[model samples]
Target chain A: MGFWKTWFSTPESVSATKSAAFEEHTASTGDPSANSDRIVFSTERDIDLYELEELCDAVGWSRRPLRKVKKAIEHSFLVASMWQVRGNQRRLIGFARATSDHAFNATIWDVVVHPDFQGKGLGKALMKYVLKKLRSEEISNVTLFADPHVVDFYRTMGFMSDPEGIKGMFWYPH
Target chain B: MGFWKTWFSTPESVSATKSAAFEEHTASTGDPSANSDRIVFSTERDIDLYELEELCDAVGWSRRPLRKVKKAIEHSFLVASMWQVRGNQRRLIGFARATSDHAFNATIWDVVVHPDFQGKGLGKALMKYVLKKLRSEEISNVTLFADPHVVDFYRTMGFMSDPEGIKGMFWYPH
Candidate 1:
């Protein structure tokens, strides 16, 4: 079988490999503390849509249809979420996803951090973790569409606007 | 099964449905003439990578690894190509692919037409066919990253640069 057929034939193994790698990384860095306010990060896709929707709503992003949001999560190349853990309770605080060609290019989308979690460096850390994961998979070009106000935030993370004179264009059918 | 599972479970059927729809549309408009020059568009993914690479090279795009290209095509939601048909000979003259969430949004990539095939209306036809397919499936937001020189070309097709003040950003890890 070709690489494509082989890769798709066993998506579970692929996800397992990613999850294991992420868990190993977290283990080395120190797992989530049981009694602290530190936020724990996860690459698991089995996230709750209600919590995700609430996170988006908390940031003032217009309500996206939960059905469509679920579909997006199902098809994404990767999804990263951050949680504020206290004892056994966990609260979803950040979310982001990427759609990639799985080799040469990947574009990040729908990056959102709960309003309560903003300005605390958690957003930056979320981005860093996401980028690190993409880089580990050997994807070379990473791109994203950002709002005008947050352009500087991305700039601080080594992202340049319209690099090499490539501009993003959109079409909304009437 | 949920929509995502059902969708991915039968990708072949999805491609077949698209191919059948495209063929029906073409047949209704007018079939390609055997004695005259006419371009035929297809949504098939079983294309020869060498021909596609040649088409990309003809447009002066940098070389992309064929292995990676194959993987990209396998993962894409849609891949459209145009051919210059003359009897049994069909030459690949245009190509484009889209990666989507299967809802909400999609991004087009690797849109290229052979240099020799430019100036004709083939590129516009290719884009129209792609947009129609996406719309048929109810995707609302369509986007693409374009070279600065072709910004006006896309603008004429109702694509605005950075719509609603959403700027494109890139990160290239060193």
Candidate 2:
């Protein structure tokens, strides 16, 4: 069992996954009582940085520069943005960013919906879109650090408090 | 003020970073008696899948396909693999993976050193390399889920126990 022997072999490139099962759940957007056909969701397509900054600011997140936010969106493995398009204009209503290896693990970050759109179910739809995207890739084991108030919201999406023995730790560089 | 007006501006790419300060800490390798110049630490060149699998197996992590491991190595925002090379042969002994937005936050995963290399201070050297890399990128906030026993190891590097009111949570899809 010489482990060193395999070190010199040529490495393979990562493969691309199929488009997620977005079509089946397109109707899951919007209130069932309202017209389901009205809302549109896009993933990593035609995103606007100013709207993203607004989405963060509207939720009281720190104001990061536009470039940082764009890099965050571009580097994420899955990004969900729910929009309300009228004529030629699009409004970013809900957004989330996730990073993963496209294999074993993923962690979701910055899940937020514009305050005005909170009760309209856009947040739930955006999360489901994220899950659908990960499921399409067969990547499970997702984690996220959440504020206490949103624990219930995340719980509804199948996230749970970490088990008894596990603890999350942080370090902030000076 | 119209918030959406900044949407059309072109954002700058995240900037490049200087090399992490790797001092004459080379003697931290195997034994002080052996010359320290033989070990080379690489951010992303010459990773061996078999040795990575062996490292994971030695520590009881779940077995993953070779390609998945290679992809994980390739996609990380920063990766450090400490290797010992003599002539044309190299052995990977320590490894760490971290993902970040290159701005605000980074979480480290799979910080492992070969069992044979455990007590030789390789882990500390590897973690310091990780911190140095993150510092250069200006990603100030970092987190990692650590085993209770290793909490002290991380604290030495400036990771405090997460403060009160913050809890890490997880979701595993069936």
- Which candidate comes out best when scored by DockQ? 1
Using Cα atoms with residue i matched to residue i, what is each candidate's TM-score against the true structure?
0.81, 0.77
DockQ of each: 0.62, 0.41
Cα displacement (Å) at residue A165, model 2? 2.4
**CA error at residue A12 for candidate 1, angstroms:** 17
Full-model lDDT for every candidate? 0.78, 0.67
Tell how far residue A51 is off in model 1, in angstroms: 1.0
Number of colliding residue pairs in model 1: 0
Candidate 2 ranges beyond 4 A from true positions: A1-37, A85-89, B1-32, B35-39, B85-89
List pairs with backbone clashes in candidate 2.
none
* Per-residue lDDT over B1-174 for candidate 1, one digit per residue giving the tens place of the 0 to 100 score: 232343346686556544644454454445354335446667778888998988888888899889999999998888988776566566888899998888877899989888876775567778987898899889998989989999999998899998778888889978
Q: Quote the positional error of residue B52 for candidate 2 in Å.
A: 1.5
